[model samples]
Target: MRKLLVELGGTRAVAEMHDDIVPKTCDAVWRVLPVEGMAIHANWSSREIMLHLHGEKILRLPPEGPVRRGTTAPGDIVYFWRSPQMSRGKQLAYSSEFQRELSELAIFYGDPAGGGLAADDPARSGRDSNLQVSTLFATLIDIPREFARKCEDVRHTGLQRLLVTRLGQ
Candidate 1:
């Protein structure tokens, strides 16, 4: 399986792509290797942090694999895209580019991820369409304690540098 090294606040974790289950999604993500940016914590999705994509790095792809209402697990990495701000709340922390077209690499770091809308926005849960799509592309093989702590720190301390690079590259 293809793997990636996810780094945040000087700590690191390893994730293996779900290439066998979602080949197209995996391929698309793999092509855009070494994604680096300031990761902001998720407001709706508990225990999650997001790395927003901008400019040419933004990937606009259709959803792949089965649609899951809930059942989001810890260490799951998702390729998420949402058109504009259709939801009730505003994404104030995101960049201006994302305000128009939001593209994100979502990392599930800790508790509250295994079930419910902690992996999704409640307002937009059942409404799956081109307007919004989230594809589970990878799963972290090992979530280091320090890495998890740094991800949690984003909630209090604000945005932190997050990098995702192809393993063995």
Candidate 2:
């Protein structure tokens, strides 16, 4: 059985797929939508928003409601980036460094899709921001814990290769 750990609003939850699984007060069981690239999973009953991190399905309070795709509902929901603040002190879980890396990746590459980095010049382009985000998300959200750590190592090396190629002697 594969289990992933997730941090939601400072609370911890473990997402696992198996029979007779235990649910924590802040945790819920969910069937991850593999096609969405490890995004949020819609609540089975309430249509609330929940994120799949490290195999753990985390549901923050005050559910974000259903996600509608045009007229058809996709049966998933998440807090819009533009939505009002979530809690009195709670901030979105994004980091400035991460965003900076993502922006660089978007401009230099194209977008952060497919979770891999492709450069016109192996010696010029390095770990773009989008790739970092993709790697982070792919590692932290999709894979199991042990594999996730390996992914992090891969991410580090990939970025270093880019950096060295770009600024080497």
Candidate 3:
């Protein structure tokens, strides 16, 4: 398994890519190693931290095979791909119907008991179901409860320097 090290300020979190299940997505992320971006609390869910990459480059890869959708747990890393036409209108549109554009990665760090269908109900799927098909590519394998709590504490404060890099070089 491929491991990734995520540093939020002084704290650290480690995640393992599920290459066996999401080979395409894992390969895409591996190609873009050592990425730094802004980590912010997700407006849709308090359990999620949104990692906004610093570029117009949208991460996209062909579906490797049949995969589960919307099911996530604490430490799960997800990739939400934006559509190309998402910015061309009076309002932003999010849907699986449009061509893929940029990608937004989210790390879940909330109570598992508090997550379920409500965490991803259709009505809560992006701004008008645009995120009905986001991909789950990895899961935190060595994250501690303290680190998870730190992430939750900054859920509202916003992290300015979130760094993601492959472990051991």
lDDT of 3 by residue, 1-169 (tens): 9999988767888999988988888888888877776676665555777675545445765545455555577788877665555434532223332233556677887754125553556554657655333678888886687777767766656554678889864
TM-score: which candidate is best? 1
Residues 106-160 of candidate 2 have per-residue lDDT tens digits of 1011112222212122322345322211111111223234433322333333221
Candidate 1 structure, TM-score to reference: 0.90
List the lowest-lDDT window of 10 residues for candidate 3: 90-99
Give candidate 1 misplaced runs (Cα > 4 Å). 85-90, 114-128
Write down the lDDT that model 2 would get: 0.23
Could you tell me the TM-score of candidate 3?
Answer: 0.75
What ranking emerges by TM-score with the best candidate at the front? 1, 3, 2
TM-score-superior candidate, 1 or 2: 1
Candidate 2 regions exceeding 4 Å error are 1-18, 23-29, 35-58, 61-150, 154-169
Error of 2 at 72 (Å): 40
Error of 3 at 17 (Å): 0.7
Candidate 1 residue-wise lDDT, 1-169, digit = tens: 9999999989999999998889999999999887999999887788889998887888998989989676678899999887765544675777666646778899999988735453445656655555787899999997899999999999999999999999985
